[model samples]
Target: MQVPYLLDVLVSVLLLLGLFFLLTGTFGLLRLRDVYARMHATSKSTTFGVAGVVLASLLYLRYLGLSSGLKESLIVLFLFLTAPVGAHMIARAAYRAGVSLWQGGVVDDFKKWLDENR
Candidate 1:
Protein backbone atom coordinates (compact mmCIF):
# COMPACT_ATOMS: atom_id res chain seq x y z
CA MET A 1 0.00 0.00 0.00
CA GLN A 2 1.10 3.51 -0.76
CA VAL A 3 1.96 5.90 2.06
CA PRO A 4 -0.40 8.76 2.83
CA TYR A 5 0.24 12.22 1.31
CA LEU A 6 0.31 13.86 4.71
CA LEU A 7 3.12 11.62 5.85
CA ASP A 8 5.06 12.42 2.73
CA VAL A 9 4.56 16.13 3.25
CA LEU A 10 5.59 15.94 6.90
CA VAL A 11 8.75 14.05 6.09
CA SER A 12 9.62 16.47 3.34
CA VAL A 13 9.14 19.44 5.65
CA LEU A 14 11.31 17.92 8.37
CA LEU A 15 14.09 17.02 5.98
CA LEU A 16 14.06 20.45 4.39
CA LEU A 17 14.17 22.16 7.76
CA GLY A 18 17.08 20.02 8.82
CA LEU A 19 18.96 20.71 5.62
CA PHE A 20 18.32 24.42 5.98
CA PHE A 21 19.76 24.46 9.50
CA LEU A 22 22.83 22.52 8.42
CA LEU A 23 23.48 24.87 5.54
CA THR A 24 23.04 27.94 7.72
CA GLY A 25 25.49 26.51 10.24
CA THR A 26 28.05 25.88 7.53
CA PHE A 27 27.63 29.44 6.30
CA GLY A 28 28.04 30.83 9.78
CA LEU A 29 31.14 28.76 10.35
CA LEU A 30 32.71 30.34 7.29
CA ARG A 31 31.46 33.93 7.53
CA LEU A 32 31.47 34.78 11.23
CA ARG A 33 34.37 36.89 12.42
CA ASP A 34 35.13 35.51 15.90
CA VAL A 35 35.89 32.07 17.26
CA TYR A 36 33.18 32.26 19.93
CA ALA A 37 30.51 33.32 17.46
CA ARG A 38 31.49 30.66 14.95
CA MET A 39 31.49 27.99 17.61
CA HIS A 40 28.04 29.11 18.76
CA ALA A 41 26.66 28.88 15.24
CA THR A 42 28.16 25.49 14.48
CA SER A 43 27.15 23.74 17.70
CA LYS A 44 23.63 25.14 18.04
CA SER A 45 22.64 24.77 14.42
CA THR A 46 24.18 21.34 13.96
CA THR A 47 22.48 20.07 17.11
CA PHE A 48 19.10 21.30 15.90
CA GLY A 49 19.69 20.05 12.38
CA VAL A 50 20.67 16.57 13.47
CA ALA A 51 17.76 16.41 15.88
CA GLY A 52 15.38 17.31 13.09
CA VAL A 53 16.79 14.64 10.81
CA VAL A 54 16.63 12.06 13.59
CA LEU A 55 13.06 13.07 14.37
CA ALA A 56 12.13 12.67 10.73
CA SER A 57 13.70 9.23 10.66
CA LEU A 58 11.87 8.29 13.84
CA LEU A 59 8.58 9.35 12.38
CA TYR A 60 9.24 7.41 9.19
CA LEU A 61 10.16 4.30 11.14
CA ARG A 62 7.04 4.57 13.24
CA TYR A 63 4.92 4.85 10.11
CA LEU A 64 6.59 1.73 8.72
CA GLY A 65 5.91 -0.22 11.93
CA LEU A 66 9.58 -0.34 12.85
CA SER A 67 10.81 -0.13 16.45
CA SER A 68 13.73 2.34 16.21
CA GLY A 69 12.12 5.33 17.84
CA LEU A 70 13.96 4.80 21.10
CA LYS A 71 17.31 4.85 19.34
CA GLU A 72 16.57 8.11 17.61
CA SER A 73 15.23 9.69 20.79
CA LEU A 74 18.39 8.73 22.64
CA ILE A 75 20.52 10.21 19.90
CA VAL A 76 18.63 13.49 20.17
CA LEU A 77 18.94 13.46 23.94
CA PHE A 78 22.70 12.97 23.80
CA LEU A 79 23.05 15.77 21.30
CA PHE A 80 20.99 18.15 23.41
CA LEU A 81 22.99 17.32 26.48
CA THR A 82 26.42 17.55 24.90
CA ALA A 83 26.36 20.30 22.29
CA PRO A 84 26.11 23.25 24.65
CA VAL A 85 28.66 21.84 27.04
CA GLY A 86 31.04 21.19 24.19
CA ALA A 87 30.58 24.71 22.86
CA HIS A 88 31.13 26.25 26.26
CA MET A 89 34.33 24.32 26.80
CA ILE A 90 35.66 25.33 23.42
CA ALA A 91 34.80 28.97 24.01
CA ARG A 92 36.46 28.90 27.39
CA ALA A 93 39.56 27.35 25.92
CA ALA A 94 39.69 30.01 23.23
CA TYR A 95 39.28 32.69 25.83
CA ARG A 96 42.04 31.30 28.02
CA ALA A 97 44.31 31.18 25.00
CA GLY A 98 43.77 34.92 24.49
CA VAL A 99 41.59 34.75 21.43
CA SER A 100 39.96 38.13 21.08
CA LEU A 101 36.30 38.78 20.62
CA TRP A 102 34.93 40.45 17.53
CA GLN A 103 35.65 44.18 17.33
CA GLY A 104 32.02 45.26 17.07
CA GLY A 105 30.67 42.87 19.65
CA VAL A 106 29.21 44.02 22.90
CA VAL A 107 30.58 43.62 26.43
CA ASP A 108 32.68 40.65 27.42
CA ASP A 109 30.65 39.62 30.40
CA PHE A 110 32.55 36.41 30.96
CA LYS A 111 35.88 38.20 30.91
CA LYS A 112 34.61 40.81 33.29
CA TRP A 113 33.29 38.18 35.62
CA LEU A 114 36.60 36.39 35.53
CA ASP A 115 38.40 39.61 36.38
CA GLU A 116 36.05 40.42 39.23
CA ASN A 117 36.19 36.92 40.71
CA ARG A 118 39.96 36.60 40.43
Candidate 2:
Protein backbone atom coordinates (compact mmCIF):
# COMPACT_ATOMS: atom_id res chain seq x y z
CA MET A 1 0.00 0.00 0.00
CA GLN A 2 1.26 3.43 -0.97
CA VAL A 3 1.48 5.82 1.95
CA PRO A 4 0.14 9.32 1.29
CA TYR A 5 2.71 12.11 0.89
CA LEU A 6 1.05 14.42 3.39
CA LEU A 7 0.95 11.69 6.00
CA ASP A 8 4.62 11.04 5.48
CA VAL A 9 5.41 14.73 5.90
CA LEU A 10 3.28 14.93 9.03
CA VAL A 11 4.94 11.92 10.57
CA SER A 12 8.34 13.38 9.84
CA VAL A 13 7.37 16.66 11.40
CA LEU A 14 6.07 14.94 14.51
CA LEU A 15 9.22 12.88 14.83
CA LEU A 16 11.38 15.96 14.61
CA LEU A 17 9.21 17.79 17.10
CA GLY A 18 9.42 14.91 19.51
CA LEU A 19 13.16 14.71 19.18
CA PHE A 20 13.51 18.43 19.74
CA PHE A 21 11.52 18.29 22.97
CA LEU A 22 13.42 15.29 24.20
CA LEU A 23 16.71 17.05 23.61
CA THR A 24 15.44 20.16 25.31
CA GLY A 25 14.45 18.07 28.30
CA THR A 26 17.86 16.50 28.42
CA PHE A 27 19.54 19.89 28.36
CA GLY A 28 17.23 21.08 31.07
CA LEU A 29 18.06 18.11 33.23
CA LEU A 30 21.76 18.75 32.83
CA ARG A 31 21.68 22.53 33.20
CA LEU A 32 19.04 23.28 35.80
CA ARG A 33 20.34 24.17 39.24
CA ASP A 34 17.96 22.38 41.57
CA VAL A 35 15.91 19.23 41.70
CA TYR A 36 12.56 21.00 41.54
CA ALA A 37 13.52 23.02 38.48
CA ARG A 38 15.07 20.02 36.80
CA MET A 39 12.07 17.87 37.56
CA HIS A 40 9.71 20.53 36.17
CA ALA A 41 11.67 20.78 32.93
CA THR A 42 12.09 17.06 32.42
CA SER A 43 8.51 16.13 33.21
CA LYS A 44 6.89 18.75 30.96
CA SER A 45 9.23 18.30 28.03
CA THR A 46 9.42 14.53 28.24
CA THR A 47 5.67 14.20 28.29
CA PHE A 48 5.25 16.41 25.21
CA GLY A 49 8.16 14.70 23.51
CA VAL A 50 6.84 11.23 24.08
CA ALA A 51 3.36 12.31 23.10
CA GLY A 52 4.57 13.69 19.80
CA VAL A 53 6.49 10.56 18.99
CA VAL A 54 3.58 8.34 19.95
CA LEU A 55 1.15 10.44 17.93
CA ALA A 56 3.35 10.08 14.88
CA SER A 57 3.51 6.36 15.44
CA LEU A 58 -0.25 6.21 15.77
CA LEU A 59 -0.75 8.06 12.53
CA TYR A 60 1.71 5.87 10.70
CA LEU A 61 0.21 2.71 12.16
CA ARG A 62 -3.29 3.84 11.22
CA TYR A 63 -2.10 4.48 7.69
CA LEU A 64 -0.71 0.95 7.57
CA GLY A 65 -4.00 -0.37 9.04
CA LEU A 66 -2.38 -1.80 12.15
CA SER A 67 -4.18 -2.35 15.47
CA SER A 68 -6.20 0.85 15.07
CA GLY A 69 -3.52 2.72 17.10
CA LEU A 70 -5.07 1.60 20.38
CA LYS A 71 -1.72 0.87 21.98
CA GLU A 72 -0.26 4.20 20.99
CA SER A 73 -3.38 6.00 22.22
CA LEU A 74 -3.11 4.28 25.58
CA ILE A 75 0.55 5.17 25.88
CA VAL A 76 -0.23 8.83 25.29
CA LEU A 77 -3.11 8.74 27.76
CA PHE A 78 -0.96 7.12 30.42
CA LEU A 79 1.82 9.62 29.90
CA PHE A 80 -0.46 12.62 30.16
CA LEU A 81 -2.08 11.15 33.25
CA THR A 82 1.11 10.33 35.11
CA ALA A 83 3.92 12.70 34.19
CA PRO A 84 2.73 15.79 36.03
CA VAL A 85 1.43 13.86 38.99
CA GLY A 86 4.70 12.00 39.29
CA ALA A 87 6.68 15.20 39.02
CA HIS A 88 4.57 16.83 41.71
CA MET A 89 4.98 13.92 44.03
CA ILE A 90 8.73 13.93 43.58
CA ALA A 91 8.94 17.67 44.14
CA ARG A 92 6.82 17.40 47.29
CA ALA A 93 9.00 14.63 48.61
CA ALA A 94 12.17 16.57 47.93
CA TYR A 95 10.78 19.60 49.65
CA ARG A 96 9.72 17.56 52.66
CA ALA A 97 13.16 16.05 52.80
CA GLY A 98 14.64 19.58 53.09
CA VAL A 99 16.25 19.91 49.72
CA SER A 100 17.32 23.52 49.33
CA LEU A 101 16.55 25.58 46.30
CA TRP A 102 19.18 27.46 44.34
CA GLN A 103 20.66 30.49 46.00
CA GLY A 104 19.16 32.96 43.54
CA GLY A 105 15.71 31.47 43.95
CA VAL A 106 13.34 34.10 45.22
CA VAL A 107 9.81 32.87 45.54
CA ASP A 108 8.95 29.85 47.65
CA ASP A 109 5.23 29.42 47.70
CA PHE A 110 5.52 25.98 49.16
CA LYS A 111 7.54 27.26 52.08
CA LYS A 112 5.01 29.97 52.66
CA TRP A 113 2.18 27.47 52.57
CA LEU A 114 3.95 25.19 54.97
CA ASP A 115 4.67 28.00 57.38
CA GLU A 116 1.11 29.27 57.27
CA ASN A 117 -0.35 25.83 57.81
CA ARG A 118 1.97 25.04 60.64
Candidate 3:
Protein backbone atom coordinates (compact mmCIF):
# COMPACT_ATOMS: atom_id res chain seq x y z
CA MET A 1 0.00 0.00 0.00
CA GLN A 2 1.50 3.29 -1.13
CA VAL A 3 0.96 6.27 1.13
CA PRO A 4 0.48 9.66 -0.45
CA TYR A 5 3.56 11.88 -0.37
CA LEU A 6 1.77 14.65 1.54
CA LEU A 7 0.42 12.28 4.17
CA ASP A 8 3.86 10.79 4.68
CA VAL A 9 5.44 14.22 5.01
CA LEU A 10 2.79 15.40 7.49
CA VAL A 11 3.23 12.33 9.62
CA SER A 12 6.98 12.73 9.62
CA VAL A 13 6.72 16.37 10.64
CA LEU A 14 4.25 15.69 13.43
CA LEU A 15 6.36 12.83 14.76
CA LEU A 16 9.46 14.98 14.73
CA LEU A 17 7.69 17.82 16.50
CA GLY A 18 6.44 15.42 19.13
CA LEU A 19 9.96 14.09 19.62
CA PHE A 20 11.31 17.60 19.93
CA PHE A 21 8.85 18.52 22.67
CA LEU A 22 9.49 15.32 24.55
CA LEU A 23 13.25 15.91 24.46
CA THR A 24 12.85 19.50 25.51
CA GLY A 25 10.71 18.44 28.46
CA THR A 26 13.29 15.85 29.48
CA PHE A 27 16.11 18.38 29.26
CA GLY A 28 14.18 20.87 31.32
CA LEU A 29 13.41 18.28 33.95
CA LEU A 30 17.13 17.53 34.26
CA ARG A 31 18.33 21.12 34.11
CA LEU A 32 15.74 23.28 35.83
CA ARG A 33 16.75 24.59 39.24
CA ASP A 34 13.34 24.59 40.94
CA VAL A 35 10.41 22.26 41.40
CA TYR A 36 7.86 24.63 39.90
CA ALA A 37 9.88 25.24 36.78
CA ARG A 38 10.55 21.58 36.32
CA MET A 39 6.88 20.82 36.73
CA HIS A 40 5.97 23.49 34.21
CA ALA A 41 8.34 22.12 31.62
CA THR A 42 7.38 18.51 32.03
CA SER A 43 3.62 18.98 32.20
CA LYS A 44 3.22 21.46 29.36
CA SER A 45 5.76 20.15 26.88
CA THR A 46 5.10 16.48 27.45
CA THR A 47 1.36 16.93 27.14
CA PHE A 48 1.78 18.79 23.87
CA GLY A 49 4.26 16.22 22.66
CA VAL A 50 1.94 13.36 23.42
CA ALA A 51 -0.93 15.17 21.78
CA GLY A 52 1.14 15.71 18.67
CA VAL A 53 1.99 12.05 18.43
CA VAL A 54 -1.64 11.10 19.01
CA LEU A 55 -2.76 13.57 16.37
CA ALA A 56 -0.30 12.08 13.90
CA SER A 57 -1.60 8.64 14.60
CA LEU A 58 -5.17 9.83 14.17
CA LEU A 59 -4.31 11.45 10.87
CA TYR A 60 -2.49 8.43 9.53
CA LEU A 61 -5.26 6.06 10.57
CA ARG A 62 -7.88 8.29 8.96
CA TYR A 63 -5.84 8.46 5.80
CA LEU A 64 -5.84 4.67 5.68
CA GLY A 65 -9.68 4.75 6.04
CA LEU A 66 -9.74 3.32 9.54
CA SER A 67 -12.18 4.10 12.35
CA SER A 68 -9.61 3.90 15.13
CA GLY A 69 -9.04 7.63 15.51
CA LEU A 70 -11.46 7.67 18.44
CA LYS A 71 -8.93 5.98 20.68
CA GLU A 72 -6.23 8.44 19.78
CA SER A 73 -8.63 11.32 20.37
CA LEU A 74 -9.48 10.03 23.80
CA ILE A 75 -5.84 9.66 24.65
CA VAL A 76 -5.20 13.25 23.71
CA LEU A 77 -8.24 14.37 25.65
CA PHE A 78 -7.18 12.55 28.78
CA LEU A 79 -3.64 13.86 28.58
CA PHE A 80 -4.85 17.42 28.21
CA LEU A 81 -7.23 17.06 31.10
CA THR A 82 -4.80 15.46 33.52
CA ALA A 83 -1.44 17.10 32.93
CA PRO A 84 -2.37 20.57 34.12
CA VAL A 85 -4.28 19.34 37.15
CA GLY A 86 -1.40 17.09 38.12
CA ALA A 87 1.14 19.86 37.70
CA HIS A 88 -0.90 22.30 39.72
CA MET A 89 -1.34 19.87 42.56
CA ILE A 90 2.35 19.04 42.61
CA ALA A 91 3.31 22.68 42.64
CA ARG A 92 0.85 23.43 45.40
CA ALA A 93 2.18 20.60 47.49
CA ALA A 94 5.75 21.68 46.91
CA TYR A 95 4.91 25.22 47.91
CA ARG A 96 3.16 24.11 51.09
CA ALA A 97 6.17 21.95 51.91
CA GLY A 98 8.44 24.99 51.47
CA VAL A 99 10.18 24.31 48.19
CA SER A 100 12.21 27.33 47.17
CA LEU A 101 11.85 29.12 43.90
CA TRP A 102 14.87 29.54 41.63
CA GLN A 103 17.18 32.31 42.84
CA GLY A 104 17.30 33.91 39.45
CA GLY A 105 13.54 34.01 39.03
CA VAL A 106 11.59 37.21 39.63
CA VAL A 107 8.01 37.82 40.66
CA ASP A 108 5.76 35.44 42.58
CA ASP A 109 2.25 36.20 41.55
CA PHE A 110 0.89 33.16 43.29
CA LYS A 111 2.64 34.06 46.51
CA LYS A 112 1.29 37.55 46.29
CA TRP A 113 -2.17 36.27 45.71
CA LEU A 114 -1.86 34.00 48.69
CA ASP A 115 -0.63 36.80 50.87
CA GLU A 116 -3.41 39.09 49.74
CA ASN A 117 -6.07 36.48 50.30
CA ARG A 118 -4.71 35.65 53.72
Q: In candidate 2, which residue pairs get closer than 3 Å at backbone N, Cα or C atoms, i.e. clash?
A: none
| TM-scores, one per candidate | 0.89, 0.92, 0.86
Q: Pick the candidate with the highest TM-score.
A: 2
For model 3, what is the alpha-carbon lDDT of residue 100? 80
Off by over 4 Å in 1: 113-118
Query: What would you estimate as the lDDT of candidate 2?
Result: 0.93
lDDT accuracy of residue 81 in candidate 1: 95
Q: What C-alpha lDDT values do all the predictions have?
A: 0.91, 0.93, 0.91
Q: Which pairs of residues clash in candidate 3, taking residues 3 or more apart in a chain or in different chains?
A: none
lDDT of 3 at 70: 91
lDDT by residue (1-118, candidate 1, tens digit) is: 5779999899889988998999999999999999988997899899989988998999888889886599999999999999989999999899999999999998878888988999
Instruction: Residues 1-118, candidate 2: write the lDDT tens digits.
Output: 8999999999999999999999999999999999988997799999999999999999998989886998999999999999889999999899889999999898888789889999
**RMSD in angstroms between candidate 2 and the native structure over all alpha carbons:** 1.4
Clashes of 3: 0
* Best by the lDDT measure: 2
